[model samples]
Target: MREQTGLGKVARRQGAATLNPIMLARDGDSRLALYAAARDHLRARGYEQVSMRMFRAPHAPEQNGPSYCCQNDGRIAARRWPALRAALPAHIYLWLNAYDRRGPGYYSAEDLAWLDAIDPWFALNRRPVPSRGKACLAGELSLSVDGDGELARCHFIPERLGNLYTDDLADMLQERSCPRFKCDCYIGYAQRKDLPFQRVFGTGVLARIAPEQ
Candidate 1:
């Protein structure tokens, strides 16, 4: 399911006083205003850091359902890159998933090239971007736990490594190598060993935001 658009309502319901809420923005200029409004709402509520992740195709279709696939239609055109970049507020850090050997939502070679070209823009504007090329921290530094306590390597990969309620957490975490060969999700790849997450966000790389300069 897509993230709810009611930023204020979500904050209130979750008691997000100290929470850094991450809003999802679908790829396109049409939704920029909606996300910008959400960003403003969060900032007004004393949230110094609000992140926005660009929606990628659900890697777990069995869980997300077939109808949720809209990667191609939702993809932002290369020609619209400048407009999209300009429209986003500086405070809202945007994340893009690297193109990988995946389906439906997989970014094309051209898209990767576009990402290379736009890397400087993100850097110049002080926005957070992933390190170039493939990298993964899944099943290594982080783990995803479902509502039922099923533990997985990452959110994108649904293969259950173990159950939190039944299995030893330490044993479950023992396997450093991921069951999958590749990871295309930003949440998975952003924590690459080579990435400067520790230097930027400290130990709380998953939740912490880089402080403004």
Candidate 2:
């Protein structure tokens, strides 16, 4: 599909491309944490601008939609990939991700196809990362709020559970826990056993778990 924006011509470049990372999340707080780190990382790498797209899920209003976090303009927040294609830099690297652990069908085949069609640089399906070992997420990797809307302790051994929220941003930032000496999702099975957790699952795998939006 042709982009609606003014960039008229698609400038295809030949050579190594600059990395333009995109992180997606369905949980608001998790999204925030990922985005916060990504923004810092991108800026440090010399990117001056970025874009974010967040919305209510197509079926579940209480939950968030498959969000888009990229180094584009904020105006592209609610728009689809075609619009984004027109706005992104000509020689930039891009990867599209959809957050799982929000339940099933968070991102569907149609959604992924749309992304792939618009940007050949789209990244989604990949060989599953092999399990490394039994690493916990509790305080070692993730931060979650409790049901009472309070920030829980930093480390919970991955067995303990809590309600996590973006509102506890300050505490989330200050708190840090290392349940293991090394944590690597791609290298090992560094995961949490509770309701909400994070890991390196393929986009197609995550989309299959939930209904498409």
Candidate 3:
């Protein structure tokens, strides 16, 4: 499963008018375009075990709706295109699973291929993303929030900072750290190392803030 920073939650909390029906519609169109791009990329690589399903939101009710169970076979992009299309938002949360029966390394290869397909889309639309001095293991460059409204380090490792109602986010980000050696997961590292600040964050914010360790 892949999710961005809790921007959706923040948007809802802030009551950002940007999530209106008109914005959602535009975002839906972008999702469909990316879906077509991903499907084509997989087919070209001769991968057939991959499947994609879109949910309205993370942990959304199963019965509520899904875009469709799109596979390599000719089942089209989505089921009930009109209804499902409208449900997608600018930030999509994807639950990717590979059932490649061919051999090992199947899942990862397919995942990388999918990332290859969507990376360009993210790059082209990328904007100036604010980041703390250090990067978290999660794909996005932002903090997660705990149930108590406190800032969290990461979903996998949930150490809470003081509540947002009282504490400073900048201070919280400064205080957080991983227990083990630094997390070097693929997506995390890609954002921190492989891509340039221009490609990822629109400007040199990361490079400027983070001098060589």
Candidate 4:
């Protein structure tokens, strides 16, 4: 999707935040402004489908919390989740399937490899995201852009691709390989305000470094 040019040599020389080359993804409840800006910026560069946008599972219990995407659509929108799935043209699934989320475990590289191969958004028009009722397929496609000028695969979430974490948007875009989805790292760290830092440390890594007891 890079036939044109938006951030040219001038931009690169200027040291602009250049594209992260990552596909930022988020449910309706997350911050999509970054994603939108990324999409617009990438599009300007003559790139089509450089990134993608998607909502979460319509039937997922909202008790967990509402995502930015959810707020965009009304509760009624979710209520019609089934109709939404039916209306969709056979190929447009977002998130992983129930089987994927099944089992007590952490995400593995195999998981990301499997995901990168997904192509759920072939046709771009939909009132609501299709429901899980439909058969699952590999949703490998441009999802959305990152705040940086990079083209992304999705709008709300960053791809771990084998690495447990990926904040580098540039590498994500430049590299098209899917097998490199195994590692463990996430950029910058911060958790919900409600959750205590101790919870994250859990007296493991921190205890070793903190002042002696």
Candidate 5:
């Protein structure tokens, strides 16, 4: 599968990977926070900063697809592993995550497959990072659970429930899957329009929870 626009031809290099120095950005989080978390994660692991281009995290409709955080070549936020790692210069791996499933947005197997064609290991933001939900989350249908626990299932007919955390993106992944598909996290949240939240737990506050289109 080929990418349509915005970012195209996403691929990866050959080498042993390190899931240490990571960046996860989700709703309610800021780009600054994302960078700090990534930097700290790497620093603790003995990695240093080289060239970090922390942009005003992408917003809804601004992104191209389910895995928009990846670069045209599907590298972490398009950091171009070699270049971004130049300053600190270490054979390390970085992650650019987003909100999770059961939050808002319909990330299905087919959608995930398309993302993989962009990047083999392009993971889904399965870990449900706490964030504000888009009042009008657009997708096949809204299938999610809020902090208070609310569910919206059914592509055509919708169903709402209280304390609905049963359908997590991680658990959803288990129901159906593709062998080659790779997204480390299980869930992610969509971006908020008004004000963003502050986080420091490797997500929300920092670039731990990567936001997608």
Candidate 6:
């Protein structure tokens, strides 16, 4: 498929052909069809391990635009979640993180309520809420690097910490408290001291996980 071809070319160029690639699908009526195609394409490439992420809105409105807003259409997504899970291939693992309404986008009380309702569903599936004693390991354990080598706590936070090319990598790796008040993204929160992600994924938390039977 065209998508697979594009991914293959990019992976080859980046020397990441051996790494497991995750296909992200946005929530919508047609997402099932998209996921099925992606599944078939990846499996055809002899990828026994595959990961899929569902994109929800209000997280990156500046880039995703108004159409990606799930605040208003969350019920539709909630209805589709079960079927999407059921349709997954036995060898593919999937994860859904609740949207925390970041960015300049607006989320009303009703939208927040929708999030409150759906977050538990995500928890029940695998992703869990951090307990009170859990410390978020955002800046300490995870960071994002832009193409220019500038670093940030994560993609959600744009404040640059340092440049990987110019600065000492060791100094930049210091553990620090998260600047944000809340983080719901998996890449950010999965590093929480309380999450079982480490036990479940071991050293491959960033890329691979055992597929559920």
- The numbered model that scores best in lDDT is 6
Model 6 steric clash pairs: none
Candidate No. with top TM-score: 6
| Model 3 lDDT tens row, 137-206 | 3323455564347565554343445577787766655433235344323233224433363343433343
Sort by TM-score, best first: 6, 1, 3, 2, 5, 4
Per-model TM-score, in order, reads 0.41, 0.25, 0.31, 0.18, 0.19, 0.44
- Tens-place lDDT per residue, model 6, 136-207, is 555676778754476766655556578889987667666655555555556666566666666566667766
**Global lDDT of each model?**
0.51, 0.37, 0.41, 0.32, 0.33, 0.52
Which is better, 1 or 5, measured by TM-score?
Answer: 1
| Candidate 4 lDDT tens digits, 81-143 | 445556755434332122222245443566444443442311111112322222111113222
**Is candidate 2 or 6 superior in lDDT?**
6
Error of 1 at 173 (Å): 2.6
lDDT by residue (30-65, candidate 5, tens digit) is 434665778777667654343353233223245445
Off by over 4 Å in 2: 1-80, 118-127, 131-213
lDDT of 3: 0.41
TM-score, structure 1 vs. true:
0.41
What is candidate 2's TM-score against the reference?
0.25
Report the candidate with higher TM-score, 3 versus 5: 3
lDDT (tens digit, per residue) of candidate 2 on 83-191: 7667866543234433433336545788667766664423322223232343344444444444334443332223323335435344444333344544332222223
Error of 3 at 27 (Å): 38
